[model samples]
Target chain A: MRFYGYFRSSSAYRCRIAFNLKGLAPEVVTVNLRDKAHRDDAFLAMNPQGLVPVLDTGTARLTQSLAIIEWLDETQAGARLLPDDATARAEVRAFAQIIACEVHPLQNLRVLNYIKAHHGQDQDGAGAWCRHWIAEGLAACEAIAAAQDHRGAFAFGDRPGLADICLVPQMFSADRFGLATDAYPRLRAIRAACEALPAFAEAHPARQPDAQ
Target chain B: MRFYGYFRSSSAYRCRIAFNLKGLAPEVVTVNLRDKAHRDDAFLAMNPQGLVPVLDTGTARLTQSLAIIEWLDETQAGARLLPDDATARAEVRAFAQIIACEVHPLQNLRVLNYIKAHHGQDQDGAGAWCRHWIAEGLAACEAIAAAQDHRGAFAFGDRPGLADICLVPQMFSADRFGLATDAYPRLRAIRAACEALPAFAEAHPARQPDAQ
Candidate 1:
């Protein structure tokens, strides 16, 4: 197995956490997004979407971090990324999507770049944009986590599964933007729990081989 | 089961299609998004995200269309939204996320509203914005569908599965934006096949109970 990723992409960070949890060590290849290396023909051939965290299973190449994480959960035996019951699984997935779909997309580098170019936003404006969206999403996630039967050490339960895999990276992103997270105590606690786990600790962007 | 959805919400349309495929007749409740009914305290109590297509299963509330569809696929066993194989599931999911995550978020009513309010983009600018992102995402989907092993009557194989579920609504969005679809022959063919089915036909935004 092989993985192509950049150090700071939250999507790639989610996959890294999943890989760590599943105990599958694939060969790591870094595609430097800062240098626009992902736009090269070689990488484009691997993933036409030109996104990070493309997993090459030798037989097929996988794109989309959430999809790749789900694939890993299904293929690997140990450490279930989702709960057994269908409802529980939906809860976990919805929590993850709160970050993956709602938060991360709004604050992605590409989106921020678009804002700067098209909306005439400057660096500070981009940072504020990231904060607004991230805070909105994390607030909603906090509400879900604080809901009566859902709170635990992780997003869903004791295990740091898919939601945790998604949360830790977004926390990293929130911190990068210097956003205040005091509004989401439950989310803060969840992030603290996840960071204590080696799987999440090791997946931090600064710990990656390609980090500047 | 009760589903709170607006007629024109593509996310809700995806769930409507899945419910049709699974043969589950959940009570349909309309939440008028245009009138800001989703922001009401009662509806917000059900889904804090204030998004349409919140499925109240009598025991739990579910949000996010893809997650809801997966829940339907897992809990009810009549029809398979995802393929049996893990690799195949990843392919379908990655294809779906190309729309759900990449395309839809950029063009959703909320995002377009943000563009209007913050960037001062008018209705025409918003339409152009949607067209740009939709075309980029659809082009990628077209490439994926045109891939050697992926092309068929649907997004994958001969089955109208999850990828097809996601593709059909996106096709609706594309057409609504007046974006040209001639570039994607395989996507157009797949859309034609999906539209021929009752599941897709009945799930159209125009066919909804609350459609204007």
Candidate 2:
């Protein structure tokens, strides 16, 4: 299996974290999102959406970060990213969407570019835009994390699953935008727990070969 | 089961259509987004994010429109809303996210309000904001729909699943925004197929009891 990704893409970052946690070593090929490589015909054929973090197994080429993560959870055995109970699964998924759907989409490059072109937001404005959404999302996540008594040292339980994989990167992104994760005590503590594991450490963007 | 939703909420529309097609008759409870009813404590107890389209099964309350839809797919056997094959499932999910995550998120009321408040974009500007993002996303959906050759008439294979559910609400949304769907031929054909169904026809926003 080959993971085609860019180091800075949060969706790829989540996949990298998953691979590390699962103890799977797939070959990593970097796609330069900065240089329009993702939009190329060959890459677009692999993924019509021209998005990053595509997992190419022998049989399947997958897109969408959350969906790819779901595929991994199903096909892998070492760590169940979701829980066995249906209700718990829904909670974890809802938590993941706090970042995937709410936080990340608004701060993404394309949206920022659109804002800049049409709304007259500059680079600082974009950065501010990113921080604003991430902060709002984290505040909601903090409340959700605290609500779960079953939420272990991690977001769901002692083991880091899909929610944690998604949470850490959004926090990492939050940090990038100069937003304070300090208000999210539970989230911060979980991030600390996740970072201690070599699996998560290995997948950090700073450790990725393509890191700027 | 009770579904909390609003007529024009695209996510809710997607869920309503899915519920109808799956042969489930969930009691409707409208969350008035315009009146900010979703932000109330009562609604937040069900979905902390305070978003509409929460499906309560008496056992577990579900949030995140995609997650809720997926849970419905897993718990029911009627329509098999996702593909049985893994590759096909990924494509179906990817297609769904193109609307759920990419298109609709950009045009969501909250984002539109942000544009109105912060960017000082007036009604026409706001409408343009809606049109621009919708056009880009629908164009991408058009490309994706054209790329596939399904055994059935729908986006993934012949059946109506997640992809078709997503496509229709977005098509309905585009119509609500007065955006032209003529450029997207495959998408238009798929929309026509969906509109021909009673489930979709009934789920249409205008047909809902609370529709203004």
Candidate 3:
């Protein structure tokens, strides 16, 4: 298997965490987003969306970080990324989706570039745009986390799973934009727990081989 | 089960299609987005994100259309919203995520309102913003559909599943924005096939009871 990713992409960061969690060492290939390598013809042919974090398993080529992570969870027998209970799984998925579908998409590079190019937002303006969505999303995540029955070291229980994989990268993005996360104490504590794990520590954007 | 949704919301449309496919009639509770009902205190308490398509099953209150659909697929046995095979399920999920995580979020009302309120965009400007993202996304979906080894009546195979559920709502949205989708012949054909089904047909935004 080969994994295509950029160092700082939140989506790629997700795949990295999942790979490490599953204890699978697929060959790593970096697609430099900064140099527009992701938009190259070869990359686009592999993924029509021209997005990073395309995992090729020889049998199948997959895109979308969440989809890839779920695929890993299903195919790999070890570590259960999703819980056995149906309702608990829904809670975890909903928590992850809050970050994936709501927050991260709005602050990604393409959207930010669109705002800058068409909406007349400068660098500072784009930062503000990113911070606004991140803050809105994290506050909601905090509320949800606070409401959870089991508030251990991780997002769900004592074990770190899919929600933790998504939350960690999002917090990284939040820190990048200089957003204040003091309000989300539970989320910050979960981030701290996740960061302490070797699986998550190795997957950090700064720890990646292609980090600037 | 009770569903909270707006008729034209793409997220809610996905849930409506899933419910119809599963042959379950959950009582519909309309949260009118046009009137800002989704942002009401009660709705936010139920779903912190303040987004629609929240399904309360008396056991679990699920948010996120994809997560809700997956839960329905898991709990309801008769109809298979996702395939049995792992790789096939990943393919379907990746296809759906292209629209759900990418296209639909960009053109939703809140984002459009943000552009208008902050960027000085009027209706026309917002429409252009919607069209731009829709066109770019659909072109990729068309490429994906065309590249599929088995080009059946739907997005994945002969049966209309998660990807098809996502595609139809997106096509409706594309038409709403006056974007030309002629370039996406494969996607349009799949949309035609999906629209012909009673499940997809009844789930159309115009066909909903809450539709204005």
Per TM-score, the best of the predicted structures is 3
Task: Compute each candidate's TM-score over C-alphas.
Answer: 0.97, 0.96, 0.99
What TM-score would candidate 3 get against the native? Answer: 0.99
Task: Write the residue-wise lDDT of candidate 2 on B101-182 in tens digits.
Answer: 7778778888888888888899889889889878988887888889876556788767788998999999888888889999
TM-score of chain A of 3: 0.98
How well is each residue in A1-212 modelled by candidate 1, as lDDT tens digits? 99999999999999999999998899999999999999899998888887887999999999999999999988886799988899989988988888887778888777888878878889998888788788888888888888847446888888899988998888888899999889889888989999998988998999988999
Instruction: Please write out the lDDT profile of model 3 over residues A1-212, one tens digit for every residue.
Output: 99999999999999999999999988999999989998999999999999988999899899999999999999986688989888889889989988988889999899999989998999998998899889989998999998888758888898999999999999999999999899999999999999999999999998988999
Ignoring the other chain, what TM-score does chain B have in each prediction? 0.97, 0.97, 0.98
Best by lDDT: 3
Q: How much of the real interface does each model capture, measured as fnat?
A: 0.67, 0.54, 0.75
Predicted complex 3: CAPRI docking category: high
Give me the candidate number with maximum DockQ: 3
**CA shift at B167, candidate 2, in angstroms?**
0.8
Candidate 1 lDDT, tens digit per residue, B98-204? 89888888888888888788787899888988898889888889888898574468888887889988898998999999998999999999999999999889989
Between candidates 1 and 2, the one scoring higher on lDDT is: 1
* DockQ for candidate 1, C-alpha atoms: 0.79
